[model samples]
Target chain A: MDAEKKNYGKLFFSTFKLSACTFGGGFVIIPLMRKKFVEELHWIEEQEMLDLTAIAQSSPGAIAVNASILVGYHVAGVPGALVTVAGTVLPPLIIISIISFFYTAFRDNAIVNMAMTGMLAGVAAVICDVVITMAGGVLRQKRVLPVLVMLLSFAAVRFFNVNIILIILICGAIGAADTYLRARKGAGAK
Target chain B: MIYLELLWSFIQIGLFSIGGGYAAMPLIQRQVVDLHPWLTMTQFADIMAIAEMTPGPIAINSATFVGIQVGGLPGALVATIGCVLPSCVIVMTLAYVYYRFRGLTMVQGVLAGLRPAVIAMIASAGISLIILSFFGQRELPADLSGVQPIPVLIFCAALVILRKWKVNPIYVMAGAGLISIVVYSAF
Candidate 1:
């Protein structure tokens, strides 16, 4: 039990440091996680890390937090997951607190305003890269439904002004049906 | 009451933001910019800048920032928890059944379906931002007169550098900020 507590401490601190130090979150942090948990701490295996990452990516919410939850759970069960959640979340809470405290000051400062305005362009570029890359993946799949779904969903949100959440639900349903059909066909072919 | 509202809103974000941090952008934009009067498009852009430059998840950073604006430090905590709570429950359940669920078709199918939609959602958000940056707002003017030259220059250059040279985005973002500082100071 005492050893479990010690391990939980290790889990907390490792995730805390990762949350605090890493930038460009999501995929950027995955490799570092692999290095730390798989190579350094030996808490997770190589393939397991890959699987965990896959699960994290496929699940909802922030990949970083999802990945941390999976890692923590694997390392120390539900309690460990709790510790890691706290660790993963606290750093941003602290850092953003400082920024929030300076919210108006930052908003009012001319240089800060200009800088943020400039950064907005950079952020747009990055977002463009993401959309292009991800859309390219869907296109590469060579499936008509996913592509149709992509375009229609785009039109729905951008033009029709449909709610984003409603779109997600409908698309998820379609995707599940597509997968299930494909799976059934594959089994019949055997 | 405000805390509860923050929590519920972020909880919706958490539940819906599949695919990753960028996927959360549209969700956050909708809540803060469109649904509520909590933030303007420019301020939303500012939060995105900070969230992008900061450590941890963009969703977490966004939740904390917006929560602080609405509530305070405790609001930050509340929003952060709401942001992460779905992930916690979902991931724990996944871990519990990881072995049995490997290559599960239903789960795979739902995510597969979400892919194109997620891409579209992200693209929609990106285009709005591009408009916002180039025009200094999310909506475009009837004529070309309102275009901001600096953001246009920065946007094109950043895109080219990012695509052609494949530079680290953190450096690109910093470079963009620095260029703005220099240009503003010069003018």
Candidate 2:
């Protein structure tokens, strides 16, 4: 029981540190998480970490939080999930709350405004890089279906302004139907 | 009443926003800017910038910021809880089932479809942000006359630096901030 408590503590602290230090959003957190959990701590295996990331991405909510919950649950259990969530969220809550108090002042400050203007440009560039890398990954796979789905999704969002939720549901249904048909075909062949 | 509203709004955001935090931006804009008048478009863009710079998920950071703007500390708590609740429940449930059926083709196919869609959503979000950065405060079909040249230069430079050098995004942002400060002071 003591060992288990210690394990949970370790899980909580690691998540806390990871969330606090990580910038550039969810994708940036994954590699750092692997280093801390898989390489340094040996708390989770490499393969498990990959699976957790995949599930985290596919599941709802923030990938960073989801990934943390999976890793925490794997290491401990429900308690681990709760602790890690707190750890993952607390940093931003505290930081943003402090910023909130100074929101008006920050808004009025000319220097700060200038800096923010510049940062917005930089952020746009970073996001563009993300777009290119993700699109390249899909293209490299050379699968017609995924490529089609990607382009369709892009057009739906960019041109039609389709609701994001509806798109996800439609894609999910398509995926399920495709999988069911393939499974049935396999069964027939056997 | 406001607390409950915040909770419901974010719960929807949390539940529907798949792929990652960036994918949550449009949902957030719809809820905060369109459905509710909690924040103006410019303020929403600012929140996006702040959320990106800060540590943690963009969705959580956004929730906290929007929650504080709409309510107070209590509101922040409520909104954040609402935002993360779906994640905890869904991830925990999926984790168990996924481990059990790790080899299932059905699961793989669902993920395969979801993955690219998520990427497209993220790319769409990036494009919107780019528009906001260049046009500044105006919506789509922005007036070219109002376009700021310095930000355009900064955007191109930052993109080149990031793509060629493989530098961390934080440094690029910091450098841009410094350059802007210097330029503004000089002018």
Candidate 3:
């Protein structure tokens, strides 16, 4: 029993450690998560990792936090979930607190500004990579219709600035209808 | 009263934003620009640029920046807490529910619909950022001299290689930061 408890604590520690230090947000965290939970610890599998990413994305929260909660709960119940959220949130909270305390000095510094510009460029690249990769995955379904929906959504928001939330709601409706229609067709075939 | 309003607004953001941080951008922009009018588009973009440079989630950084703008330090605290609280509460509750309904078909159907929509949100965010970077500008600069596209290129290259080669991104981020300092004249 003692050994089992120790195991949970260690797993708990590692979960937050990964969460706290994870830069570039959700997609980048995927590989690290798989490395720790699926490969090293065997806590979950690759497919489950992918599923969790979907769940985390669809849920209303920061991706890192949602992922941490899901993984924490998976590993050691509610306590683990609590610890993971704490772990993920602690670093940001501390860093932001420090920045808030000395914000004026930090904001006015030229060196910091320069560094920030470079960092923003880097962030854009990271976000770009995510979009391209996910787009590729979506395209692989070999269904042109969803591909068109995705492109039109991009065009609408990017060029027309038609409000993304509305696009998402529209696409979601289409997806639901697609699923229902397919299910009905399958039932008819049976 | 203002602080309470700030807190509630962010909590609404946290609870309803279905596609994580990136997806929250448009809604957040609406709040910052249309409803709250705390920051202009330019300032919001600048703050977003700053958040990208720092560690942690962009949404939290956004909350901190906007909060500070609205009510100084106290506003930042309220906004940050508000941004996180709903998700934290919801996730905890969901953890319990997830265990019980791990095998239900309705749950499965909902997830299937949710997944692609999430991806769509991320794509939309990327587009939003791109628009924010270069939208409705009157004059193109005579030269690309003020902006060093090289650093951005190198950073992107490093990220692609890191993702492709399975390298540690922390080392990559640290290395990029150091390289940026030495390679450029601190702008």
Candidate 4:
């Protein structure tokens, strides 16, 4: 029981530190989560980590928060999930709240304004990097269907201005049908 | 009243803004800029930059920023809670069932389709950010007359440094910020 309590404490603090320190958002948090849980604690296997990441990405919400909840639950159930999420979100909440109090000062400052202008450009570049890396993963599959879905999704959003959730739902239905047909064909062959 | 409105709007943002942190940007823009008029386009861009620099998800950062802008400390708290509540509930529920049905064909199929769509959404978001950074938000028929060359140069340089040299994003952002401070202050 004592050991379990200690484990929970460790889980809470580690998640807090990771969320507080890591930047560039969701994708960047994955490797750090892996390092802490899989490598440092040895609580989860690398494969499980990968699976959790996949699930986190596929589900709604921030990937970082989703992954934390999944990992926390895997380790210690509901209480663990709650504790981990609190840790993960608290830092940002505190930081942003403090910034909130001084919003006018921060907004009106000339130096800050100039810095923001440059930071916006940098942020755009960082986002471009995210796009390339994500697209690279899809391209590596070397499959026609995934490529087609990717392009169609882009066009739907960029040109048609379709809601993203609607696109996700349509693509999901198509994927389900495709998989079901493939399964049936394989069974027939057997 | 404003607090309740903030909460409800963020709940929608948390629930419907699927994919990842960046995916939430459009919904956020629509809600805060278009629907509410709480923030202007330039202010929204600044918030986006600040959110990127800060730790945690962009969704949370933007929520907090917008909340403060609209309602202050209490508003920030309420908005963030609203933003994160859905994830907490949904993820917990899914976590309970996920491992057991890991092999469900429907689940696999949904994921197969969702993955590509998520990537495309991120790409689209990136393209929009690029446009916004280069040309200040001047509606569909953007006033190209307001285009600033310095930001464009910085953006190109940052992209090259990131892609070719593979520098950390933090460093790139910091360098850009420093350059802007110097140039803008000097002139």
lDDT of 2 at B96: 88
lDDT of each residue in B1-187, candidate 3, tens digit only: 8899899888877775665656666567767765787877655655655554456666777788788778987888788888888877877676567666653344445444544555665666554444443331213356545544655465567668666975544455455555666667743
Candidate 4 chain B weakest lDDT stretch, 10 residues: B136-145
lDDT of 3 at A163: 60
Off by over 4 Å in 4: A1-4, A140-144, A186-190, B140-145
Task: Give the per-residue lDDT digits (tens) of candidate 4, residues B1-187.
Answer: 9999999989888886667777788778768876798888777877788787789988888888898889987888898889888888988787777777654457767777677887787787677777777886634334567778888999999989999998988899999999989988988
- Per-residue lDDT tens digits for candidate 1, residues B91-135, read 899888895656555887899899899999999999999999988
By summed lDDT, which 10 consecutive residues of candidate 3 chain B come out lowest? B131-140
TM-score of 3: 0.73
RMSD to native, candidate 1: 1.2
Which fraction of the native contacts appears in each prediction? Answer: 0.91, 0.85, 0.33, 0.78
| Stretches of model 3 off by over 4 angstroms after superposition | A1-16, A27-54, A71-83, B19-21, B33-35, B39-55, B104-128, B131-187
Candidate 3: lDDT of A142?
Answer: 86
Which candidate model has the greater lDDT, 1 or 2?
1
Per-residue alpha-carbon lDDT of candidate 4 for residues A92-186, written as tens digits (9 for 90 to 100): 88887787677679879989888988998888888888788778998998989889999999999888888766887798888888888888999
Chain A TM-score, each candidate: 0.96, 0.86, 0.72, 0.85
Backbone clashes, each candidate: 0, 0, 0, 0
RMSD of 2: 2.2
lDDT score at residue B51, model 2, on the 0-100 scale: 82
- How does model 4 score by TM-score? 0.90
**Superposed model 2: Cα runs more than 4 Å off:** A181-190
Tens digit of per-residue lDDT, candidate 3, span A82-132: 777767765666566566567667658877655544554455555566666
Query: What's the best-to-worst order under lDDT?
Result: 1, 2, 4, 3
- Shift of residue B177 alpha carbon in model 3, Å: 6.0
